[model samples]
Target chain A: MSVDTASAATTRAIVTDAAGSSSRARRGGQRHPATSFAGIALRTPYWVLTAGLALIFLYPLIWTAISSVSPLAGTNQVDGWGFGNYATLANYQAGI
Target chain B: MTATLHPPASSPAPPEARGARRPARRRRGRRTHGALAGWLYAAPTALFVLLLFVLPLLLVLQMSGSDWPLLSGNQGPNFPENYQVAVSNRFFMDSVIFTLKYTVLTTVILLALSLGLAMLVQESSRWKGLLRTSILIPSALGLASASLLFYVIYSPIAGPFADLMASWGFTFLGTPDGALWSTIFLIVWRYAGFYMLLMLVGLQGIPDDVYEAARIDGASRWQTFRDVTLPLLRPTLALTTVLCVTGSLLAFEQFYILTKGGPDNSTITIVQLIYSVAFQGPNDLGVAGALSVIVLLALVVINIAQIRAFGKKAED
Candidate 1:
């Protein structure tokens, strides 16, 4: 809605210039059609770099999730796996 | 009104116009009916607010003036005594200062960092969607849940980053400063995406032609950001600041989970001190209620001042 609502200047010229544009201000006009495979190839580094950075935001939770059931030393996983920790939690605080 | 609705006197009324006529009497009746329906729809929420919020607030106010013990419940009114106790409590000043520090630091860091991330995401590259989703993923989790996750993550004994910290000889929750910064890091990580989303909405609402114009004017990136974007983003920044400050001031769950206001109670927030007074040591619910009322008053004042500041800026 915002994108379409901003139908000000016909930004065809600016949008096409995105390949050559390296500045933040120039990125206002984006979403140009991929004219060649070279453009797609060029964008792969950005995807990789950002996706890798995204992992920094994500991996802690993912790690905690994995470790929650992986028999960590201090957990209440009495039976070595499967619902033991949850059962213990259910019984915690005088059965809630 | 009748003359206007009836159209020209010279012209015969169209059948459609005659059928669609909205007479004042009928309109009034319809307004009454609509009002009744609106109230009917709103009744549940009104009742909920009454039961959950208003009653609790009133009860807290009552407790603040009365000798409300944890086990024996409300003893007779001890007006001004509880307030005196609350103000004179050992942890009051420290917790207030700590809460203010946390609030200020987190507000500045979160707002600035989120604004930067918003600009980074503003570019409609293909990674825009992917990066937005990933960053926003943390915000989907509850604050308490995120704190719990961080509590374990900050554990040097079994944490994923245990060895990394061990190699550096730094433990996240060992020193008071470490605890504060670590908790702030967790907070920033968890909330950055949410604030970024807010900023992004603000950013997107700016017409592309503004940027085009600025570009035409040959303004530098920083100049454009300062002159154009920041000024326009004031409303969003105000909202974000209020939310950040309020949330930080009322911080409890994270400190409770991660440090328990520990390393000698260095991280105890105002809410935590209130909790401590209510549930532990001397266990005076009256003092806690008094503390709660004071906090509420402070919050109201702070929020009003913030809004006023923002309003003045916007006027300028």
Candidate 2:
């Protein structure tokens, strides 16, 4: 049991040393923090523009879902909310 | 030790032959089991299609024969009377002509635009990703939603283009011609990118070696494209054309939202007429069902014709 414990301790030490060296190597090879920050700043405008365009494309469906439930569906007024509009679908002569 | 523990390689009855025979029997059993498993896996999809598509189609056929009303229960079978009434309606015939016209125009424009865009974007370039994404963005919007947005855009009172158009002494949706053109424009803008994506997939399936061989043979760009690309793209083109025609024939939302069959019902689609017949007015569900059956028959005929045409080219 003592021999077994001793060997297990040696194995644990070897693994820790290997992990520490690899981490040090990675840190050494990585770009400077300031350069990485500048890279992100440079890419920001493209992301912002694309995101804005995507929102514009999606706004119509979002608007329709909201308008369907809004109480002022036929009227210009945009106040109050209920399932009143949906009830009209049931009132139609055909079974939708 | 060897004589006691092991068997001799040379025996009167060969072990190798016996071993091969055993494995062959096992393989035959495995093949039979594999076929059964395959059928078991396919059974669910077959059942689903039967229940949903075939059953509903049979029901619709039965409904078309009977005097089915919207609110009341089904009456006794009226046979061909409902079909005769549907066929005799002048408005229904006019809607059919209008739907055919729209289908032709939309399919032609969509094919041309999508093919053009696909060619432009086929090459690997810097802006290809952005161009593809930006173009496809409009297709993500539902047809109804896009029509509503265009409704606002075409409104004379509150439209952003109202002032510009007024300055030019023009109206976007004032007349039947104007409304039809506007709706067509909206549809083209919405679907061109989707069709372009389909065409792009077809284009990418082509190997680079084919183009290289064409170049080595000293064929001009236009000649090479005409001879090779068009022939190869036939299958994809057939698929897109069928989809475009079917969807255009069933068009309802754009006209309903943008024009509301306006300027004297000139923009009324066949589907809109069916909707009015079944849901509005006297609510004759029987006639509506007959009309739907007629439309389904037309679609099946068109699709079969398209498939045959494409198949002939493939054989060639």
Candidate 3:
């Protein structure tokens, strides 16, 4: 019973400490709410732009990956997907 | 008993005094030993550099002054004649011009794209890791491998976008303009990430308080970037610019694999010209050696100029 009571008291202390810290953080945050909002507003567009550019930069690799598996790759006609292109590597002395 | 038997002048020193004196002497000896060991450890690398680099450089210089043939041996010192022949070659002159043009274009595009990407990645809040990794993935690919991949992409028949591009009436690697742009695009794709990493290091080195101060002063984004970021990033920019310029000047592999100096040798670089001269038919190894010497001298001069320019700016 004493051990249980001790653990319960510690948990209460932790909860109160967390609440106290959060309240302090909230007070600090409220002091410059407008600046924080403006900062986010300024950064949002750049974040979107970053994501778009990343996609563009990665497009070639993505295309290469998809083409490696597609049956139409290196051929004029598009067809069902197969591993024939990869399997053909076994025929070459260099082994790809 | 010994202390009592011996006179004052002949008596041995006390144990504590001897102990202190011994350590001082041992420490001095150890310092010398440590320095010797350090040099010993560095000797192999120094010897390797001397044998591989210095020896070859001297040999090349000697060969440049002689009429070194492809099939036979050197025919004694020819001196300025080999250099004169290299200078007089129209094809060599054309290759040099093309290399300079390519270097300027590649350096400008790579630096701009890398700086822009670095800034974007640095400012990003949520997807910074993902964006950086995706952009940097291409840099992990070997240059030759990337060139081969791009070769397939630039193909008229085998490319994934072949039909789509054909419908648009545009060929990527068929003509001179198309080929040059395609090669530039490939290089930018391959190296932008690597350079971006350099610029990002420069960016992250900047303290947050600097930006905070700029913000407090109500500086616009462009103003802050110009006044603060660019000045601070000068050293990194200098390094990347020099690397890009030198690498572009010596470009050969991509052009060799993709175009073979194609659409009329328009894309041939200085190194490619040297390779052809030394190895190809009508092989002139002496002229090639001279050309190599000229190139090495030019590179050294350019690097020195760049370093001096950056060093001056850093002092100011």
TM-score of 3: 0.80
Colliding residue pairs in candidate 1: none
Which tens-of-lDDT digit does each residue in A1-96 have in candidate 2?
Answer: 999999998767755654555355434332335268876686578567646644544454455566667655354434687666666665766764
Writing each residue's lDDT as its tens digit, candidate 2 over B1-316 gives 3566446654445778888878899999999999999999999998999999999998788878999999996998999988998888778888999889989999999898889878765655445566666668789889988898888767676555669888887888788889888889889878978999999999988765566556556678798889889888898999999999999999999998888787788988899888888898659999888888998999999989989998998899
DockQ of 2: 0.05
Please tell me what DockQ candidate 1 reaches: 0.28
Name the DockQ score for candidate 3.
Answer: 0.15
Which candidate tops lDDT?
1
Instruction: Give each prediction's DockQ, rounded to 2 decimals.
Output: 0.28, 0.05, 0.15
The pairs that clash in candidate 2 are none
* Model 1 chain A poorest 10 in a row by lDDT: A16-25
Winner of 1 and 3 under TM-score: 3
By summed lDDT, the worst window of 10 consecutive residues in model 2 chain B runs over B4-13
Q: Which portions of model 3 show Cα errors greater than 4 Å?
A: A1-48, A73-79, A94-96, B1-32, B123-126
TM-score of 2: 0.70
Q: Per-residue lDDT tens digits of candidate 1, residues B1-316?
A: 3555554776877987766765755898999999999999999999999999999999999999999999999989999999999999999999999999999999999999899888878777566877888889999999899998888789898788889999999899999999999999999999999999999999989876676677766789899999999998999999999999999999999999999998998999999999999998779999999999999999999999999999999999
Per-candidate interface C-alpha RMSD?
5.4, 15.4, 9.8
Model 3 misses residue B283 by how many Å? Answer: 2.0
Clashes of 2: 0
lDDT of 1 by residue, A19-92 (tens): 24545334544344455677677767866877886897889878966765766556786446556567677788
RMSD of 2: 16.0
